[model samples]
Target chain A: MRDLLRILSRFWRASLAAELEYRVNFVFSTLNAALGLVLGLFALSLFFQNGHAFDGWSFDASLVVYGLFTTFSGISSVLFVPNLSRVVEHVDKGTMDFVLLKPVDSQLFVSTRNFSPWGLPDIALGLGVIGYAARRLDVDPGHVPAALLAALLSLIILYSLWFALASTSIWFVKVYNATEVLRGLLDAGRLPIAAYPAGYRVFFTYVVPVAFLTSVPADVLRGADATSWLAIEVVVAVLAFGLSRAFWRLSLRSYTSASS
Target chain B: MTFLRRARAFLEVYYAYMLVYRSELLLWALAMSLPFISMGAWIKAADTGAFPLAPVEFGRYFLVVYLVRQLTVVWVVWEFEYDIVQGRLSPRLLQPADPVWHYVGGHVAERAARLPFTVVIVAFFFMLYPEAWFVPSWTETVACLALSLLAWVLRFVLQYAFAMAAFWTEKASSIEGLWQIGFLFLSGVVAPLAVFPEAVREVVLYTPFPYLIDVPVRALLGAPITLRDVLIPGAWLLVALVAQRLAWRAGLARYSSMGA
Candidate 1:
């Protein structure tokens, strides 16, 4: 595990240097991320115009959900998605064979290859949004530790979700936009999960795992009921990780390229 | 006759390509359906009185929104950016046909091929919400339909200009993300502008994003729309077109593609 951390740190440095060569892009990306936050705020404000609260949650609660989803999405995009998008390219160009031949796990290398340091702006902006939304909701600082734990779990679920979705690309070469679909599904998290019909809320929470990514963290931040779901979240995260690992290995068996 | 001949030849090639990769087109269309799902959620929310929105109104509004998105969303910018990065743009530029015309032809052809799928979605909306298809006045519906066409043209041109930034910038994906966020909030994909703050809605009225989707959707769903409403969106369409031209001209000079 320490060696893995050392390797990731080296890869991260390499990625930063490569990205820094095009510095203006960093500014544009920051601006782009800021625009996403602005849009989320605007959407929340629009929803609030219709009612003081949607379903049982106040506008502040919804914003917390949006912010949490944004934070998770931003981190996922920063750390995992860029590498995931490149999976097709590597496969098409036969560069994936190199990854398979590496001493480390091919999945690990492929999953961490394209870390973008510039996406840190999104993380900062998302956290700021979450902080502001928490303040609006009058959330207590005493709950900060729990909220952080929920947020970390949410990030794990999100990362695992991406892994599961992206692993399909190894088998289905046509699935270039699966990550976008995942992103869009995450966008569903921008709204308060409780605002959805009970059936959808249940599905999102249990089946799809969106609730863990947005609602649970938001609820924890709001001092709402989240403890009951914490154990379920952990179980789901572990299951998701196991399933994705299985899928990744299955895909590898069918991979045409060989180290030879 | 000469123009028709060229158009036919271009469309033939385009259709052939579409047939070969038809699944990709279907996937793209399916990927775009998340907004419809959000609209569905809003409709149900309205049914439960979660918001002031009437269920039928929400249905009508979102159907129009989905259709407008189909017409207005442009993929040119990202396509150019990818082509540039992959070193394919240079060869395309060397072709006898102007690259812009080729792209326009490609987009037009893709739109044509996808028409069946778009119509199926519209038909589903019609079946589910007959009230949304209600036409109080034929003249109004016709005028709105015309405006919708104009809006799509302007939207495509606007996005093409932005996409042209790939000629200079390495972060066109970030630029596209910013535009998408703007579209989500300002363009009425999240909800109708009527749901936004008066001041915010008023400011957005001046921007091109609303005309891209919201205005046309409103005009279509609220058929028998006033002459003034019809004219405002038309005027914005003209402005968008002009803005697109200026941006395109400025961007073209900076484009070096992969060779440079």
Candidate 2:
């Protein structure tokens, strides 16, 4: 694990150096991300127009979910997109064979070999929003650990879903854009899970598991008892990660390289 | 006669290619299901809140939103960026027709291929949420189709205009992504404009974003629309056309596509 961390750091540093050459792009990306966040918040505000709130959710509490969604989107951009987009290219060009022959774990190497600072603004803004909400709500600092734990579990579930879908590219190169479907669905996370109807609730929780990514974490942050959903979330994170790993290995078995 | 024949040729070849890529197109169609997801939230809101529209009306609004998105979605910027980066544009530039025609042809063809998938998804959605079922009058149907066509053209022109940024920056799609942020909020995808505050709705009407997604949606919902609604997007279409012309001239002068 230490060696993996060392190699991952080296890879990220190399890409970061390359990306830093575009200072103007970084600035534009930051401005764009900020604008996006503002507009997103504005969209959320619309639902709260006339002081109406979803059942059991105030606008302030919804902001926590919005923040988590934005943060996870940032995490996706930083890691999932940069890597998964390349997985298509690597497989398309038969470079995956070369990657597989390497000494280290191919999945870890591919997943972390590139880092994008473009999503940095999004992460910062998301954290800023989360902090802003915590301040406004005046929550006791005692709940901080619960929030952190929920955040970590949600992130794992998200990354696992992304990797699991992206790994299918080994057998179906055209499935790269399948993530776009996942992304469109993830927009549901921008709202509180309670805002959705019963059918949507069931689908979002069991089918896509979007609730675990946003609402569960936000629920914990809002001083709610985690007892109702925490165990399920833990099971989901473990099951999702395990599924992604098994799927990747299963896909690799079917991969046929052009260069070979 | 020659122009008609050439256009047909382009469309035919692209149509064949799109048929081969029908599976990929299915995923792309599924990606536009954000409206359905948002519909669930809005419909749920109507059940509890005192809002402008009823639950069934909100369902129809977002169902139409899904259709508008499917009909008007554009990816020319991504294709153009890839062509520029890979120097594939050079060979296309050597062709008699402008490269934009090829992209336009592909988009039109892909829409044809994607229609069945869109139908399937909507059918499934209706099965699940039968409250959303409704049929517009013939006049509304005809007017909505015409408005949707205009929306598609406006979006395509706008995206193609942004694609010119690839000559100046290799990643023009990210620039186009900024436009999506605007679209996500102002285009009435998240909520119907009727739900917005009177002041905000008045202001948002003037932006080009609403014409791309909202006008056609409202038209299909049998909402009262004036001649100005059509005129505004028509004006933006003219503006984008001229802008794209200028951008094409300037960008071509700067373009250095691999030994050109």
lDDT of model 2, residue B84: 92
- TM-scores, each model vs. reference: 0.90, 0.97
lDDT of 1 by residue, A64-100 (tens): 7777766776787688777877787777666778888
**What C-alpha lDDT, on a 0 to 100 scale, does residue A4 get in candidate 2?**
73
| Best by the DockQ measure | 2
Candidate 2 docking quality: incorrect, acceptable, medium or high: medium
Off by over 4 Å in 1: A136-138, A258-260, B48-52, B83-97, B119-141, B225-260
Candidate 2 ranges with C-alpha deviation above 4 Å: none
Candidate 2 lDDT, B1-260, residue by residue in tens: 99999999999999999999778888888877788888888888888878999999988888889888888888899999998999999999888988888998999988898889888888997898787788899999998999999999999999999999888987788778788888888898888888878898899888898888888988988888898899989999999999999999999999998957
Residue A26 lDDT in model 1?
73
| Native-referenced Cα lDDT, model 1 | 0.74
Could you give candidate 2's per-residue lDDT for residues A143-257 as a string of tens digits?
Answer: 8888798889998898888888879898888666698898988889999899998888999999999999999988888788876698899999999999998999999899988
Q: How far is candidate 2 from the true structure (C-alpha RMSD, Å)?
A: 1.5
Residue lDDT tens for model 1, B61-143:
87767766776557777777787778777787677766677677777788777778888877887886677676536665775
